[model samples]
Target: MASRKPSTDDTTHKLKEDLHHLTQTIEDLVSATADDSRSNIKELRARAEKRLKETRDRLESRGERLYDEARDSVTHQVDACDRYVHDNPWTSVGLGAAAGIVIGMLIGRR
Candidate 1:
């Protein structure tokens, strides 16, 4: 008996045939079970949607709380800075002018 050699074309043809057969099998299975799969997907979608909505609401409220905290912190800082500037107006004025000059120079360079 002569031994047969495996060719690339033959291998590719066999792979294509196998894939075609698998595709047909999958199509038949899906056709037979599509209703059940759709029902399950619907239930999962509803549950997932509800959970997502709840999570969104929670995150939105959390964001509001964080925004309030940030505003309070910023207001407190501005008040403290204002007090310091008022208490030491001369020093603050000198520092402010120096900072303004440096900023002006930087902007001019740009």
Candidate 2:
């Protein structure tokens, strides 16, 4: 079976969950430090810092992936449009002229 790439919504949801987990971890660390004098503050701090670093790395990687996905999608669309225009030059020209005329009429009214 082929693995599927996650959609934008899925990625966004995962990021939100990661952020929430990070927030919870920090909160726990704070509460633990404040509540117990004998508690291992160093271990708690280390864990919180590790979580924060992991979340930051995940966010950075996801942002880069999102940027690359958007760029690729736009490039694909532009290529498809270029192909269509080349294949149907006259139709594309007519459509462009029609759109321009419509815009001109709308602007003239204003």
Candidate 1 lDDT by residue in tens digits, 30-60: 5645666877656555555565565556557
- TM-scores, all candidates, are 0.58, 0.84
- Candidate 1 has which clashing residue pairs, if any? none
Please state the error at residue 27 of candidate 2 in Å.
Answer: 0.7
Q: Which stretches of candidate 1 lie over 4 Å from their true place?
A: 1-39, 105-110
Output the number of the lDDT-best candidate: 2
lDDT of 2 by residue, 4-110 (tens): 99987998899999999889888988888886755577778888899999999998998898899899999999999999999999999999999999999999998
